[model samples]
Target: MFTRTLLCVSLSAAAMPLMADTVWMKNGDRLTGTIRLLDGGKLLLETDYGGSIPLSWSKIATLQSDHELLVKENQITGERAKSLLASDEGKVTLANGDTPKTVELASIKQIMKPKPFVEDFLWKGNVDVAMDYKRAESDTDDYDVDLKTQARHGKWRHNATVDYNRELRNDVVSTDNWGTEYALDRFLDEQWFWQGRLEYKRDKIEDLARERTVGTGPGYQFWDNELGALSVAGLLNRTDYEYADGEKDNFYAISMRWDYNRYLVGKTFELFSTGEVGKPLASVADYSLDAEIGLRYKVTDWASLNMKASKDQVSGSDGDKDETRYTVGFGVGW
Candidate 1:
């Protein structure tokens, strides 16, 4: 009976699978996990005990991936090569069986799809809702909800966002605004992409009832890495606007858009800013500007607190056509 028990225990132990990835940290720490991906200089490592860890390349001294990965060599213009990865001392040794190619680890633009068909296509996004309620002699309320997502498949990428908000003071509605935006990108090279964008918005307080815009442009990604990204694009838009007074006008304009984002403190904090300026080719003075700046403080893996301020300015409108808003809220997302 003792021999049988020992034999069964040994068999079970031998059948268990081990983690396929190992990371050696620069400070002499070691970790074992399943590697989800390596993108933009960050590695997604899923561990049994710690859930998912976002480990930057800078923190990693060496790594070994048991499975093969598709690698993009620091430039989208280059073709992807499949290889088993071994990293040590700032170099990656690729195993393709013909000849061993050693490349700088920093020269790898991205790596993904270790299993061929599964991880290359995936979707990830976050949803945030913030609100405040106060009861005094009069009741006050404010709220905003935002949903954003990005998905990837091969060389194509899709992004979308939806926003809704409401504000009340002294039992009177002060502001109500909502909008939806969708964008698609087709990457032609590492730094250049062709994009199409569509936006629709309606604001009751600003008396801007309806807005529809369609634009196509060339975008340049100045930087995308572990720290963050900055992208700028110039687009020609056909815009149609309607006022709450039932007046409407349509025009064609050239617009410049800039988006900047950064992650700090081990991805626990975020700062972002985006702005757009439009100049009507027919009426240059009839230009407009819109901008927003926001900060996010992550409270946990799936929760965050956010503060945001935004400004909207429109030209040739009657009676103080500028609107500004400040809001605070918390959100939960995965």
Candidate 2:
């Protein structure tokens, strides 16, 4: 009985690799794992023993997958394959029911698991929190919470963001503000889209008690892939401002907005920036800018350490305003 059980255990261990995706390297190394995706010259493999490993695409001799995947070739459209079959060096075959198409590995631009038909949307987002405390002649405490999320389904995409900030000095509230924004994009083609957005901001301790904005414009997507994305938009905005002293003003403005992010070193670090600058057509304010630049270091697949600098300025409001802040925080991303 002991001999029979040992034989069964050994056979099971040997059969595990046969059930998973396998890659043959140019240096004659064999690896078995689940192929997560291939992008930005890196093929990501999820392994039981080594978590996720990124392999250089050029160094792969051949590969085969047991599951279906979407493969894009030469920056063109993508096709769904039932499986991948290893061919000669630098070649792979997409296996369908009865027709297997062989192609050069160098011609493949991207490979990703397809989302289920019932749930055809991709969702991603991040939440960040930062706090500051100082003990001196006067005690100070500061807190900030930022949240951003987006979902994409076919030609439609939705984005939402929320921010809250508070500061206290000597047990007295010094700064308290919160803001929220929502935007929707409808893609006309691969790179062009139209966007409509609404934003609202409120401050409890400033003369600018309330602000509202509605904007719509055309945007261009430069590129969006596993590595990073960049996009820009031009907008015509209608804005309303209400002051704590019972003063109100409305203006029409033309503005530009941009969002950019890039990942480096196998996605271990990310550098990002996003902001909007606008010139109000009316005299309520000459120009306004709100922007933030940040860096994130991935601590794990979902956790990160982040540092950010933000600036908010208005040239010709009731009182000229300029504020800058720096924060170190932790965040989670998906």
Candidate 3:
């Protein structure tokens, strides 16, 4: 009889009973319950009216149920009915004539978002062996040893950077420079943001000068949590400088930035302040100011340890100068 009708359709597909998967994590979050056991590594979901939700499984990555169960039992019963209507005996309800109360359960406040950046999309670069001490004015004491490398990626969301430098100047062991920058960002509502950047530079002791810059901007992200976001941005820049002696210069600049992110011991801390101002294209010449301060430390998700202290002062020309640079670094892919 067709082998007993294929053994009664394989025992009715093994007596049907299976549908539970949807856990996805690593920071983007999504759940659907029904694990019931995993132990040490965590995971005990069961959730479908019959609650129970213990998680962790290395912050899950995947687990998609065959047909159901992946977090949606009426959105966990509307978050347990909005935590029992924000409790206080669920605001006691029993108006007149009859009594039927059993709604207590409110003490709400569970908000999550912002995790999963375990180095999300980063590809760092580093190399620095320093010993530079110089006393200028007539140049007498000088020391050198400088090499650089840099690479960065998203979670800046979009970024690109390149750098290079070889030491020893006044004593003329010449050659020092390389620079590149590319950036693009967009996030319009969660505060507001929009950005664009493009830069290029080549400096071989100043005279071989080559520079280019383009910028666009608008940013204002009052603040965002999980320890990051506090912004201010405004930019408009255009510059071109080419000189091998046959001089040429064109300028226009205006910039600003103030940004920060937090986390202490485990690392991850960033702070920033920036400024720029320059103007002169046709004449009516006069305006220049530049500033900076930056810091970063993140041991790993990829790798990081950075420090920066900078200053550049220039105004009107003549005898105007002020400069300082200090950097300690390490960084790698995310």
Candidate 4:
């Protein structure tokens, strides 16, 4: 009876199957594969799907067996060695030659997913609104609301703004003035861009000034978002202005702009100066210098507010000796 019981136990142990092997990496990575070689501190492996892979030993954090196997005692050598194969109900030997403890493949937790080759794509836009009041040392109080929007996609961008104000004190002209401007930009590469813009102004006095500007120059992207970018564009401009008397003038200008995000939480600075040359349109000629400084605040993802103050000096006959304007407004962008 004792011999029969021992035979039954040995047969059961030999019939059990081994569990899968799991490989863990020091970089918090893991894989499941059969180790083919552990020579020279590196591992050559065959994954379960049958692909061969090589792993540097320096990159491995730990290795564990899935099950335990037992080896019988050798009476002649007076030594006992354990099997390295895993089993559901038996102890196994580890790579370190240590006797197996309870090891369960089903309990191993996956750490993280494989790293991606590219990160997220970003998009952004903003609009602003604000009120502006201005008074000359000897003129009536003028007030206006300003609106601005900035938008961007990939490496391309655009910005637009408008102002509506009561002319309160200027003589020779009515009490209302409105003006608008637009610009489009293209990023040539990671560090440079090109841009163009158009601007128009109208007063109740039936007088108008229109400008079409196009220039290709380098731009530096200081900051940016999905909707727009803050950059400085060096520009060479061609401008034409028309008066109520049907007189017109054209000139060249050099300009630079500092733009902010649409969200209205940034600042912008600009400088403009025209060369002394005149286009022979309507025999009208003029040269001007202009500068602007502004600030914007984002009210939300869709809307924002901004304020800008500008100074201009024209050194030609039939033009203002000098003019200045302060503006504030709000706008929305999709």
Candidate 5:
């Protein structure tokens, strides 16, 4: 009797259908696993036999999800629904139980897995650090570090960035600088947004001790595609400055910021440029400009090599000069 019972249980378990997801390749290969994320022209899959595998978007012929997903089409913003594979040749079924909407595989922009409401609001951060040294004649050392974090919930997004740099000469600290910026953006629609930001920094070499700025304005997303993106915003800002010589002043200014990014080598490499200009209402000649250009080469599924050059310029009562800085750092993102 015991033998019979064991056999019955084993048969039931074996007869149970698999709940795992599936992916079909253009070459007629079938992968059975859980679909993790589809981003940057690549699809991630977690399998029982092999570990996580990244399949190029061009190679994926069909996608079948075991759970609901938030999908974005080339024309539509965001929709939540179930999906199936192989229902058609070059389309995916919406599976809404009504008139199924067939979306062209090429028109699908992004796919996100569903998570708990609170988990969607959790922050994700990336950090990079680099150092340099010169040992002949005059000893000098330089350091650069940056940390950035962002979170998205519904139509609102929050971002924070912090960076610090220092130079040492003969074991003494010569240049010490650090800054942090916090920004909040609320999306009004597909291409427009309202933005606010606060920033603080200090420079010792420019006869400047500390600077604080607060700004907010409207912004626009000109184009966002698989290849590149561009965004520009204008802000009304109030800046306060304190120098090492015990002089302090504040001014109202107009500021403009722009950022551009392009993906090269099909997500393996990235090129980016960003800049900001500010002019004080008291005097137009007294202005500030900050700009940076950088490239990041993806090394793994989560890490990259980063290199950047930036120029900081200010001509005002407290300082008048330009500082150029270069850095090479290793960064990781999630």
Candidate 6:
């Protein structure tokens, strides 16, 4: 009985590789791992020994996967397959039950594991905090916190963000502000969507004490993938502003908003920018622009070091405001 148990355990260990996804290279190399996703001509494989490795789609001779995945072809729609079977060079067969379909790998646009249920979604976000303290001649303290998150399910996507900043120099408060925003997008097609947004901001040290905005418009998603994403929208907004002196102004505005991010060097570094520019119709403000650009260096899978510069400007208001800030901080992302 002891000899039989040992033989069974050894056989099970030897059979483990058969269950894993695999890719064969033209140079006669074989890799066994869990296939993560394919995007932008790169296939990501999660390996026990090497972590996540990205292989060039062009260099792969053949591949197979044991997990059900959604495979898109020619940048069009996709089909779900129970597993992938290696066929000839540069080809794969999608095994679904009794009916199997073979397709050229070069025509495959993207491949990703599908969520188990319709209610499942993909969500990612990050939070960054920056603080500075100095004790020389004068004491200075500055704190900035920014949070952003987004979730997508089926045709609907949700986004929310919050920002807070405070600075004190020589025990005197120089800046204090906070803002929160939420937006929802409903995709009409592959690249078009409708977006509705609401925003509110408050400043304790600026002439503009409070601001609120509501807007809706059409947006275009340039592209979104594991590497990065870019989208732009045009909006018509109703905005209300209150001054510190108890004065209020309301106006209608047309604005353009953009959000973009790109990952580099195997996703170890990211460059991102997001902002909105608007022109008010009633002359409440000649033009208003709020924008931020930042870079992040991934220290680990979930931790990062980031540097950001942002500008907020408003002209032709009762109290014109213009401010620029720079921050260096650490963040956690998922």
Better of 3 and 6 by lDDT: 6
Give the per-residue lDDT of model 6 (tens digit) for 1-334: 4335334543564576676887877666779898877877888888889877878889987787778998999557889999987767778889999999999899998887764322358899999999999999999999999999999998898999999999999999999999999999998887899999999999999999999999999999987865688999999999999999999999999999999998765566789999999999997889999999999998877899999999999998997999999999999998
- Cα error of candidate 4 at position 174, Å: 5.2
Clashes of 5: 0
Instruction: Write the residue-wise lDDT of candidate 3 on 1-334 in tens digits.
Output: 4325334533553487644444545464556654433333455555676455656555554343332111212212212111110112112121222442333212111212222322345443333333445667643322222222223233344545555545565566554666666767565556666878787766666553676779788877675443344666777777676766766766676766544444332224455454455554434225545444556665544455666665544444332334455656554433
Residue-level lDDT tens digits of model 5 in 77-183: 76777765344445576666576676877777777665532334656666878888999888999999988777868778787988888999998888788888998
Evaluate all candidate structures by whole-model CA lDDT and list the values in order. Answer: 0.73, 0.87, 0.47, 0.48, 0.75, 0.88
C-alpha lDDT of residue 180 in model 6: 98
Query: What's the candidate order when arranged by decreasing TM-score?
Result: 2, 6, 5, 1, 4, 3
lDDT of 1 by residue, 99-173 (tens): 767787777766664332212785766777778899999798988888878776765668788888898998799
Clashes of each: 0, 0, 11, 29, 0, 0
Where model 4 places Cα greater than 4 Å from the true spot, the runs are 1-143, 169-175, 205-216, 225-230, 260-290, 295-308, 327-334
Question: How do the predictions measure up, each by TM-score?
Answer: 0.70, 0.77, 0.27, 0.45, 0.72, 0.76
Model 6 off-target regions past 4 Å? Answer: 1-18, 23-31, 37-43, 48-119
After superposition, candidate 2 runs with Cα above 4 Å error:
1-20, 25-29, 36-43, 48-50, 55-62, 65-119
C-alpha-based local distance difference test score of model 5: 0.75
Q: Evaluate model 4: give its TM-score.
A: 0.45
Output the worst ten-in-a-row residue range by lDDT, candidate 6. Answer: 1-10
Which candidate model has the greater lDDT, 5 or 6?
Answer: 6
Better of 2 and 3 by TM-score: 2
Give the winner by TM-score: 4 or 6: 6
Best by TM-score: 2
Clashes of 2: 0
Model 4, 19-57: lDDT tens digits are 445555545465766544333334545575756465665
